[model samples]
Target chain A: MGEKIMVKGTEAIGEAAIRAGCKVYFGYPITPQSELTEYMSRRMPQEGRVFLQAESEVATVNMMYGASSVGVRVMTSTSSPGFSLMQEGISYMANARLPAVFVDVVRGGPGLGDIQPSQGDYFQVVKGGGHGDYRLPVYSPSSLQEAVELTIHAFDVADKYRTPVVIFADGMLGQMMEPVEFPDPVDPSTLPSKDDWALTGARGRKARYVTSFDIDPYKLEQMNLVLQETYKKIEAEEKKWEEFMTDDAEIIFVAHGTVGRIVKSTVKMAREKGIKAGLFRPISLYPFPYERLAELAEKVDIVMTVEMSAGQMLEDVKLAVMGRAETPFYGRLAGVIPTPAEILEAMMKEIRR
Target chain B: MSEQVKDAILLASMPKALNGKEFTYCPGCHHGIVHRLVAELIDEFGLREKTLLVAPVGCSVFAYEFFDVDGTVAPHGRALAVATGMKRAKPEMFVLTYQGDGDLAAIGTAETIHAANRGERVTTVFINNAVYGMTGGQMAPTTLLGMKTTTSPYGRDPKREGYPIHMMEIMRALPGVAYAERVKVSRPQDVPKAKMAIKKAFYAQLLDVGFGIVEVLSTCPTNWGMDPVEASRWLEENMVKEFPLGVYVDKVTEVMKEKGVK
Candidate 1:
């Protein structure tokens, strides 16, 4: 209920977390996400909470793990390469089923990827980028408002699933300024109690064991089975997506993160040209809305997957459609942010196909 | 040996798991014995539930499985970082890191030095068994001169690779360490002394007495191509001469002495 003030997506996410009652901010200053960490560096100390510029990305995630283990709302933000460095710790947190927010502002490449924007980490984020048979609820936001909302939802989903949650963004979304409004600050007291798992100074209870240990081989396997079942429940219950005009579109534009925002403008231009084009944005990357995509595939003739990498999400789009519709792809690689015109160009190609 | 002498030995005998479990150390390897001693102390002190053991990745990647209580497997040489996180997060909880010479002195050198330098109220259980045992007994920073291992098959040349690091001297240099002692668990007679050093390290974490390390001169019989008996003897002769057994820093009662709100 207020006029919009311009803010970078990264800063907006940090401010949103602070408003959402996050107590600890642990991060290493990497490109793109540096704005978020800088915001925390200035604000967190004043708020009388903990803010640590950790030794490394690995240490940063571990710090988030430590703080999260004790029931404090904590988060760590980084980019693609830094997120790669954090995979082991992220896997560790996933195994422990710790609820903490991780923001991966994607950049390009296999190593020390470029500091500029890219959506190369879509597969990594959705597939539980760590070395474990585990999954975290990953949210891909299109705009500054979506970034804040998705980040808040990421924390909630993390707590609900008792697993790590990721707010997957790109450098463009992180650096670009836009207006945003936070829903409401969650009261720590009102939040769902994690008494069973959290190692807080709560009332009488046996030492809440937070470990990935089941001594017996059969028992460990059974534990893994149980985790898998829980993941299934998440996939079934928490799939969120947004559709613009999939009702009678011959061609659909499937994209996410900042690329999704660009896709929207392309769809509008395609509609002006009398071409049937629609936008499908996957808000949750994991527990991916495949069922919905398959249903929509029946209605569309061609589905064009647009991403900032050499066609990573294209494979997922194909899987989601499962060959019901002819799925094609377009990509902008290595720190290249796809413009609306570029996406429109891709959409025209999709319409012709 | 009379009944009273036998009873004295029985009372001194370590319990299981403090006898810590299933160490993958080679024969003549004193790490197993020393690890057992740490476990025994933890068992005796009833610290199984309260203690957070930080096991580094060198030879102890799966140590979390052996440790009964909450055990975190830290990255190579990053046991200090993991322990620091645990200690800072749970200020009231006991945090101790079990590290090897290679892990602490090599890649993780900075973390080990900084944690000690900062007096992070974390205890380090430094196992200074002259050579790296897991990766085919290669020369460690603490490897004694002329000690033949995989890396130094032609004997450790002081001219090329410098002399062995004196950890006791290094520990003494750091102001954070409340206690740093070089002990060898090669002999049955010396196991108790090694346990005492380990116990002090554990207690230092319990009492918030800053960084404490117990450097145990372990023997690896397999690497030495000797039986357990000979390796123990080798440790006494060659190892003890290089890393002379003694305390580098001792302020076990510093917490009790300090007149301030912790």
Candidate 2:
């Protein structure tokens, strides 16, 4: 463990990326996440790395695609609208099987929604926002320390799977500050070699090219099948979640990210009121802890989902519960962050029903 | 007779930087000529083993297959932005982008302009063929004022569609641009000049200066509805008059002089 330092969430993510051997960062300024870009602009030069403020999110994501193709670690941070603009480039990088990382500090929006924090981008990030058959390994961290840890882990996951990894944070997380103890900086030289597939000038080897295109439908289908296999492997190996006091609980609350930590409070409130409550928080949104959630649903009479959006993750909770438990949802829409008391009251209503 | 046959010498052949595969371009399309020039320059610079080409989303989309160097295909109009990332990440490697008029001047205008403005140390070969050949002769941004095409069948009207965009003129205005030139291969006499401009553009990167671009006024005979010879003549007469051929910016020589080299 390294020395503990107080840091903002976006800046901590930037420092974590630098420590994780990220060599290049291309980004465009958007609210709530611009500090990460600003942080990189200062830190990358000091580290003898590349940091460029792209003309737009469209350009920024393509730049990531370019840098990643060269077998170097690259990343970018953006808010919801910028993330929306990056979808096309993400699809390209995903199909090309290039490894890269992105941090979407989600802000409110159907379109230019306020800069307030929101979990509105759950479907956009976990479900394929980009046009294609692809899945990104998305990590939702509940605290600043978890945010720092996940940012570093996302890079390794991206390289291991040869696909894009996303750190699904939000506006509140971006603004909040907390003391974080970072792991030691990774020595880039000691990292796994990508020379076999990386575009390293093709010297002393047969010329190589990377592309996601195949003019023939049969060949394209084969490529998609390979992608599907990768996703299946990831789903099998990467499901992660945290269960708090669920060993003997009758009601379990499902949540993730900032709302997840808040629901921990809700769990405490419910337990004090003698309702036997617990919390289940998903860390990996794509390879969701479905199997465990289903098992927990069998033990609990009610599974309640709380979110900062209009219950987008509720659909997944329902799918996991599959009517084994009475699944109810409580959500605050349009960038509203619900308090623990509100969530506890909502849980009580479901219990009474 | 055997001694005479054995003594025969080879004068000219294909460039080694180019893979021996035949091009898919239609007869009289200038993409073949431009590809040869680019490959020859890579060979001349001895950069074959240290080059990365960003292939565009046009007729030259398969340029990666043609060039015997490491490369990848960028989505339509994002080649320069992609190349910017490549060059920045690996400054030691020579990066280049090959884009057509539609891909560069239309869909990728922002990427092209901003890349130049940022002075990214990458080379760009822009092919201004006045029409989108791959998509069956749709009117491109560089299409002539009165030119007829699949989309502009009634001849381009300045009222409905804007005038032809002069990308070289745009490049000249950018402070980050190190070299910007407009050339052509319409006439046999113009081929060497086109190659020279391309070489200068490549030198802008090789010399560690700034952004470099050479807009080659090319022809698409099939799309232009003319025979090969007629199309060449038409490009020379019409496109040349609209987009004047010359060096729009030349910071390469100044930088070379500053480095105390010829």
What TM-score does model 1 score on chain A?
A: 0.95
TM-score for the B chain of model 2: 0.95
Q: How do the residues A1-353 of candidate 2 rate in per-residue lDDT, one tens digit apiece?
A: 88899999999999999999999999999998999999999999999999999999999999999999999999999999999999999999999999999999988888999999999999999998989899999999999999999999999999998999999999899999999999999998888898988899878888998888888899999999999999999999998899999999999999999999999998898888888999999999998889999999999899999988988989999999999999888999778899999998888788778
Q: What is the interface RMSD of each candidate, in Å?
A: 4.1, 0.6
Model 1: per-residue lDDT, tens digit, B11-63? 67655344234566565666667666777777677766666666776665556
lDDT of 1 by residue, A1-353 (tens): 34577888888999888877788887888887888999999988888877777777866776676667666677889999899888887887787778889999888887876788898887788887777689888888888888887788877888888888888888888878888876767777888886666655322433234555544789878767877988999988999899988787878889987788888888888888888888889988887888889888988778889888998878879998988888888888998877888788876666665
Best by DockQ: 2
List candidate 2 stretches off by more than 4 Å.
B1-11, B257-262
Q: Which candidate is the best by lDDT?
A: 2
For candidate 2, write residues B1-262 as lDDT tens digits: 5765643521157787898899989999999999998998898789999999999999999898789999999999999999999998999999999999999999999999999999999999999999999999999999999999999999999999999999999998899999999999988889889989998889899898899999999999999999999999999889999999999999898877788865
Model 1 misplacement above 4 A:
A1-6, A19-21, A65-71, A192-220, B1-49, B58-68, B75-77, B131-146, B150-179, B187-209, B247-262
Q: Model 1 TM-score? A: 0.85
